[model samples]
Target: MRNFYSALILLLCFVACKETTSGKKEAEQHVMPSAQAVDTLLKEEKKPAPKTFRTFENLADTTFVRLADFSDGFAYDLRYATKNNFLKEKVYDCAECYTRVKTAKALLKANEEFKKSGVRIKFFDCYRPNSVQYKMWKIVPNPQYVANPKKGSIHNKGGAVDITLETLEGEELDMGTDFDFFGKRAYHDNFDLPEKVLANRKLLKETMEKHGFWSIRTEWWHYNLKAGSNDKVANFKWNCNQ
Candidate 1:
């Protein structure tokens, strides 16, 4: 009887030990999954945002569109809206870059090509109302400085843009001169500039030309879209508070 009881107790002890080990392993499995699931959810929350672009199919080629609504990649430092420009007065109620659909399309393609070289277009000016052109004419009245408001500038026609190259990191390229710097230093034909400046201007000019844009001999920063220059000059304005 004593042997029998000792054997029975040993058996019970072995079963209890086995059960404890199994229970521990099962608890570990449950705890591990919960922790891993929480970690995965946190990672998902930190993922990068999806890219967004506006649809342009419905818009007419001549229709003026806000460039920002189409793509967020381009940069803007609209000069006429502030006193920093040669005008020395804020002629616009706000700074907004608008262009015709065709011009915008060409610009978008040019920007894509620019991105391949780690650069992008930064606009100094865009579609200007004839009224704003008149204001600029009032300041300088020179046909050379401000395009005659009566004839209407390519800007008023939504065909031209004054722009420069900037890196993806927002550093401006050495284009030798600032936008609207009415001097020989700002001319595309000027070759006396630093090599880097010439190269930068070359890249800008070539890429724009390939995209149906033509640069003026006098201004390195100005580009006119061939298809849009014939469009009617517009006096319509954009909403400033929007």
Candidate 2:
């Protein structure tokens, strides 16, 4: 009878041990999923939110707007913002592209057309403040290059842009001279250039004209919006901290 009791107790102990081991494994399985779920949630939270662009739906045409805030399609060099420009001095506090709402609209349309030709506009300068115009004039007091600050060029009116063509992949097209090149080589009428360069310039000029922009005779890169010419010359500066 004692041996039989002993055997019964052994059987009970084995069953209890098995239940404990199984429960432990089940608990571990539950705990592992909870840990993995927490990890996934953290990763999702750390991910950056997608960028959003502003629309010109109700904005006034004369209102100034940053081009990058509207679209990410175009490129910029913004030479005056750096010392690489003809002035050899950094004129702008920061590099930012801003234009009148009407000018921006025309540019967006022009960029779309340029994209069709596997190229896009790359700006060297745009929408210069009247104050910056004075800085440029002080550096080069030539009417042929820098416009008079008192008179205020189309740029100060937010109507002009110095731009060039580049491939969608960001390769600049050869147009015989770089931006701010003051010579006959950069002149629109001076056609003594390689066929490739002339073709590139022609593409830019024709496309810009189609999109309500007119080029200057002296500078192939400079273009003025036909409708934005009458806008007031602005000294409004962009906030660089943003």
Candidate 3:
């Protein structure tokens, strides 16, 4: 009788311990956080909030000028206007081309150092309107070379720039082809290009990148501000001439 009672007590203890272990295992499985869920939460926290400011229309009463006119440190020989082998039409209200202005100032300061090397910065295109961007897109919808007109282009926002290298006397270097050329030749790293052209492209790219500008891989002449997207849109109509 004593042996029987001890055996029964041991059995009961074993069953209770097994049930408790199973319950704990089940709770652990249900309460664990998924790796994906944690990653998603981290990403959500990293996103920046959008900003709002006064519209361009609200600043209509204030005077504005093209960045080029505001400072003489940089030089502008609008390539399109000349009877050269390049496009020749000005599509921006010069005064409202803030990106160009900012770029010019940076280049001017950089040129002081580049002048020792007999190199200078030149402008090919600046401050394009949405209308002209659409026209260009119709000509070539190359995503690597040109921005889509259906979407708001950085140029339309007055923050995109097209530029090249030139001699102090204003002679353009061989950058493979004209600005907006949609071909492999325009690539900064094209192996078939002459060494001089490649070197010139590298100089322009490095200098611009140093001053907070980034280059498009497909077009050597194209460089937009690294932080240009931060600029808010203005509803103020451009002053055709400033």
Tens-place lDDT per residue, model 1, 190-216, is 999999999999999999999999989
Predicted model with the maximum lDDT: 2
Candidate 3 C-alpha error for residue 117, in Å: 2.1
- Candidate 3 lDDT over residue span 149-224, tens digit each: 7775666666667777778887878877877677889877687888888787878888778877787777788878
**Which ranking of candidates, highest TM-score first?**
1, 2, 3
**Cα lDDT for residue 56, candidate 3:** 32
- Residue 219 miss distance in model 1 (angstroms): 1.0
Residues 71-106, model 2: lDDT tens digits: 889999999999998889999999999999999999
Q: What is the lDDT ranking, best to worst?
A: 2, 1, 3
Off by over 4 Å in 1: 1-43, 46-51
Q: Candidate 3: minimum summed lDDT over ten consecutive residues — where?
A: 54-63
lDDT of 3 at 234: 31
C-alpha root-mean-square deviation, each candidate: 3.0, 3.4, 18.9
**Candidate 1 vs candidate 2: which has greater lDDT?**
2
The candidate that wins on TM-score is 1
